[model samples]
Target chain A: MVPAADNQTRSENETKWQLGMLLSRPFFSIGRAVIRWINILGAATVFLFLALVKVFRSKQLSKIVQQLYYIGARSTTIIMLVSVFTGMVLGLQSYHALVKFGAQGAVGTLVALSLIRELGPVLTAIMITARAGSAITAEIGIQRISEQIDALHTMRIDPLRHIISPRVTAAIISFPILTTVFDLIGMIGGYISGVMLLGLNSGVYFHSIQANVEMKDISDGLIKAIVFAVIVATVCCYQGYFAHMRRDSHGAQAVGLATTSAVVISCVLILVSDYVVTSLLI
Target chain B: MNTPLIKFKDVTKSFGDRTVLERVNLEIYEGEVTTIIGLSGAGKSVLLKLIIGLLKPDEGTILLRGKPVSKMKKKEINAAFAQMSYMFQGNALFDSLTVYENIALPLLETTNLKKSEIDRRVMARIEQTELTDAVKKFPSELSGGMQKRAALARALITDPKIVLFDEPTTGQDPVRKNAILSMIAQYHRKFGFTAILVSHEIPDVYFISNRVLALYERTIVFQGTPEELEDFDHPFKDEVIHSLEALQKELTGLYSKRQFKVLNHAQMRRRAFGDTYCIAVFTLEDINSIIRYLGHDAVQEAIRRMGLYIDKHFGVIGGFSTRRNTNEIVTVLPYSDITEAENILKYFVKDFQGLEINDIWTGVRRRVAMAGPVEFTILAGIAQGQPIAEIDSVIDSAKSHQKEIWTATMRRRGEKI
Candidate 1:
């Protein structure tokens, strides 16, 4: 019963609407993802700020020390183990490349610089994220679901002060120290591969590291470590602390998901921040 | 009238699209035990959280002592919080901390008390909670009951004027559940603190509660004294309360009324045309007086003990029992005549009389001292019925023939019965 002109107009309008929806869907998805990430980042920043404000609460020293033992001291063995293998591989590869130009002596310089400037902080952070960071997330997630955090609130105790601040403080103290250990142990691992196994001059290896390494490089690496520590601690604690808010899961499953997300996000943030810090400092 | 201690005025709370509580209005008086009863997940805990400012309402106001909590300054909120304590549904004892450390944490964090004072208070609480042996153990290392006690000890350590208990006896056995309720009642009387309890321990909680708030369908459906609640007619009463009673029957190892009918039907199906059965109704006489002189807890214990004795004697003879009401147990002995039932009833009476039911009163006596000796009697009535007979009529006949078969005069601990 419709007129030709009216039918034509309706068809054209439908086509336009369909085309518009088709074109805007991707933008809509991208916008949604962007907004979600922004919300997460904003929430994490607030959580970190609140925790930092309560870092100096009464009797916080003991809690921080305990976290240091867990995040820094307990992780030392795994850090050392991974660092040795990584340094040995780096030594073997660099030796092979440098010996092509009769420049194998520079292997020491390359190993020391690479580990001190980049590998030490990045590898140490990733390893700790797998070890201590996941544990923190799971622990806090369990506390969240089990109402321990609510219990703390009812007791008039700030959970951020009691739980998160100590871990964050410990991370700030521990990361740089652990990174320094990684550098030292990794360089020794390079020595074992370059000098002891490949017959490079031991004196040349030590002298090259001594002569080429600068305080700026060490400080830059330490700066990266500190940044990585903050990112990892904040992301992990935020994930666990708000696990109960996750819509996709509940209870123990939520805890597990939070732990996984914490580790993944922490490692991503660590590497991404490392690059940014390195670019600024360089 | 005195002003309410905490009042919720047209409060509404929602999570995402789901509205948990809608325009909920309730008042809690000071120095009285108020219990919030409802179906699970009906926002009872949400109401408690609103009172304590753990969760803020999406609309309206929560007032503490006539002052709005949301409008209170930080110092005012802190002062208000200092007078309150909450025991969570799940005993949220910190797993990493030892019992002693857990109990001592609040004092250490909130107060500048001397170490000796903290130690004394912590040790006293631990001893009172009977956690002295488990003081060094972590929460994970303790039994479920022990963890609950530990959590209770922690909640009470601050000696707050207002205590919020969220299903405090959820995972306990009947005996332990009664003990915990008694403990709360005793403490409430001793400290004169306002106790706000969220519980599913029906009838038991009603005894200790001065006011009962029934949360149903996302609002406070009824709020009044326990006696008033009993008389208040609402779907919540038939749905939540009756369902809980049914659940209690299962928990207490007795059949519910419906279950008893099904069982009786099954018994009838197995019976021959000429075969007869006996129905006996055992009523704990003077229950109202027992509740008056002794207490609800004592009457409950007596009923439970009677049910157990009935089960023990009749269960082996292919008989089953159901709690007919608050003070009566109905037993169906299949394929047994009146004489046979009478003989079994005599043995039951003898065994029950010798059962030393006074042990159940020991804990109650410590709290409530009696002026004179109170005697408790159980009256039994038996009636013969054919398989085709109406169960109601037969039960009525048994009730009409009721006579005292056993009596016990509650005496002093060392006095002869």
Candidate 2:
């Protein structure tokens, strides 16, 4: 009976100690996390600055063109598909909502404004983050894990300049152009839905859209697209660049985790920054 | 003397709280293949990474060709790296890139070489590595050996003045290993580049290495030619040369019977060079009586614990233990002085008194109480400059004399005489 009581007390003491440890873990974890992020951000900023300074100094025009092809030209079909579907849904929903107030002519303005000013850029950024950003992270992470990045360093080739800069520049150039294509196709889809499907007046639909969307609206969205592009590319490259430094995981699992983290982080940041930029622009 | 091509002066490095290297000093001369060998997790890779500036040391300076690498500017370091090439152990071939493109990468990225020139150089390297057939294939398509050759080709494509190889022959067949070593040696000789390699292939590496550096206890413990490595009397060097099994008892981490064999071999081999070897025998007095009181398992546990303590204290200073007979253990201390042996014997008494015996059978399944303090007496015999055959006689006489003295001293004290 005494031993059992002693065992119970020992177990209670152990549980209390474990609970204390559990309570203390978050503080240390947060501190380590903060340090890790600061280091990552500092290294990433250095990489970006170094890449930008040396990006044009080296003559890799062919390589940049190759990257532009991979990032932009290959993505056009998917962007078109997503834009057309989003525009059709927006057109259908807005026509029904505006029809209730007996002002169905304003459906064109709503669809065009949403597609050109908000949905086009945000959706394009999200899609690119899902497609290209994840891929870049995995590719770079694998290179890091396989030591190709180290090999490049040994060869006296700055990996940031040779591997990352072209991809970044291509994404920056590609995003705005992709947003433009998405807006154009989305407006066509809106016109098709509002006029042919909803039996709205075609003349009013086209005129209202043209009159409502100013150059500033388009330019503002393009600027947002550029910002999102930079954020996504930088985040992906940073995650990949430092994936090997993670001691908790390695090999394919590390690369996979890095890719998922890159995509998720970039997408969330894109949405949040989209709201922030919209509020600031307005 | 001419300046060494690479020099490490009091270099120290640590990762977090773990110190990987401590005040390491080494010098690698030009046009020589120096192989560094050590146990796993002994900072062998850290030393190689330090040379290439992939890892920065916490303290001290590494000079490459009279220039301090750690203090160099980015451009300076890159320029220094341009003349140096490192072949990675895992053969870091770019998977997405074809063999030709991978080999052509340095020319494309660093050098402003023309397409024709780049192609010519790439083709030459491909031919040299015998990967012409797989020039268009990706790294994943090639076998491990082929990928290693491709990586080597890429490393050598820029014609670096210095090459660092990290385990160039690991996980390879003997034929491939020999081929790789010969290729490295031949290219090093032809190009007149200094080569530094970290490898576990000791006997094979001995043929190509002009010098060998052994890393032990986070420091460069031994640096000399292969002949010197073979002739060195240090227990750590023995562990590195002929597998750790030869130097340590696997279960106890104490010096095994192989240490005695090595001592005998070293004594015989160094006799012509006029070097003297010594042996000392230590017996745990009445250890058998204690075993009889306890059990066989407990006796084994006690010996293991005692061996661990002795190894931790004495192994660093060229002292290692092996079981001599059933109840006796002998420590063979080569190049040892009488004072050092006497000091060790004196320290052991105090150390043994303070030592605690851990309960080996305590767990959730069997809740056993911790064991009490273990007490023991030790009798020792020392023999110096004796032939391997005659050393046993000397130890026997010394053992009998020491036992008699211990008994008389205990009798005088009225203890357990």
Candidate 3:
């Protein structure tokens, strides 16, 4: 009987330990993830601080210009293509929706408001994040893995000052400009679709858009563009710079992983921060 | 004694639960070529990175001159770092930049020197390393040897006080390995800077070393001059020496004639550029009698075992051996002194007598295992400061005078003088 009691006590202890593990596992993982995020944020904050301080140097101007060419000037064709198609779709769909209620005249207001307040900035950011952002991650990740980053450090050059600052600054400057350009092309596409193709009054379309679209709406879109720029640049650079620190092997796979993660995380952060900023502004 | 240029005081480093280095203490004096020899994962590279502050040690302190690296301010550390350069094992030249740009980058980034001055320094380094033809080419366009030289040029362009090399001879062909070693040694002489080299290429690296530190099993197992390492008698040290010998030679435990060509070229290079070396040829005098008595299989086995023994014993003092025609073996011992050469001869005679041959074909070609001592004598001649082109004549001279030297040595051994 005493042995039975002892066995029962041992079984109870085992169950208690298992139960404790089950109960604590989620908390443990969450704590680990939170710590990882905190560290990433701290590194990114320091990088951003250093970048801002070094961005104004005369030597950085050429690099920033080079970045502008790579990020902005070269990206014009794709942005135009996507924005024009999106505007045409919005014009066609909103025409049908408004015409059913005999308010087809208000199609311009719907198209302009959607593009200015949301579609323009969101789509442009996604495109830039896919195009230039992944490239940045790959370039920097290769440098990190190849020991070029360490070479720079041994040379007594701050990689943050030389490599990261121009990139982040260029992204910041490029996003808002690209968004504005996208909005303008989109309006033109809307006019073409709603007036010439759909047989609506062109003057009424232009007049309604101009009358209803406020400067605040455009400003909000630009602000979102800038915020998205920060998110994408910070995420990409942070991922690339720390690529060697991860458990991934230093090869094509590691650089690919860094690029993919940078794009995914930046997209998620952009969307979430968009909501936060929109709510705060409202 | 001179003060240490760099000092590691009880340095301990670990990754997770795996300890790489445990309380390691070492010192590198100024103007000395200190080579750290170790197995692949023995934390030799990590120790180098620790000295340069690329990776910090878990515990203990590294001092540059007398200043503790960990305690220095950021600006001070950067300033201190500027005085040192590292040639990475992979020759980490920037993939995107031309060789000229890659070498010039450090000067451009760190110093306030004018472009003209930077260009002059970069060109001088390029010239020093014989990289004039590959200046505008990317690293991928250059050969492995050229890339290493380019990396070396880049490391030296800054005129650093100390240069650190990581596995400078790993993955290199014998000729290129000799060239790189000779180049580094020449530059080290030209500029009296402290050099710390980490390599797995033993005995050969000793040819260019003022001292050696052997890292084994999470700590430094031995530290001394090349001569001292030759006398070091530990199981691990023996294993390291034998492994290095095995690594350099072919399956028969003898280097090929091709490797001989490389070594001869290297010896000529050392003779041309800096140091003096001696080449000794040892011919087995009674091979026909031994073969008649023990058969062909037994003789071959004896020769193979003798190859291993010669490699182990003579290999200690940068003496590399290779088999010649059939009955002779030639070894190049990189020393200017006749005493060291004589010491090799003495040790070889003593150790060759003790080497036992076990397998034999005897009694109507039936395989029999016999453990017995073999009777043989070695006739050797020493030639010093000869070029590769002149080596054949010296070897021939050694062969023709073999009888006189043998008779004289035998008379002396018998006290018949």
What DockQ, between 0 and 1, does each candidate earn?
Answer: 0.62, 0.53, 0.54
Candidate 3: tens digits of C-alpha lDDT, residues A197-264 = 99999989999998999999999999999999998888999889988777856677889899999999
TM-score attained by chain A of model 1: 0.97
| Tens-digit lDDT string for candidate 1 (A95-165) | 99999999999999999999999999999999999999999999999999999999999999999999999
User: Which residue runs of candidate 2 sit more than 4 Å off their true CA positions?
Assistant: A1-43, B71-76, B244-417
Better of 1 and 2 by lDDT: 1
Error of 1 at B97 (Å): 1.7
* Highest TM-score scorer: 1
TM-score of chain A of 3: 0.95
Error of 3 at A8 (Å): 4.8
Cα lDDT computed for each candidate against the true fold: 0.87, 0.76, 0.79
Q: B139-206 in candidate 3: lDDT tens per residue?
A: 99998878998999998988888999998777765545645775677678779888999976554566
Segments of candidate 3 deviating more than 4 angstroms: A1-17, A248-250, B250-417
**Candidate 1: regions farther than 4 A off:** B249-417
Error of 2 at A166 (Å): 0.9
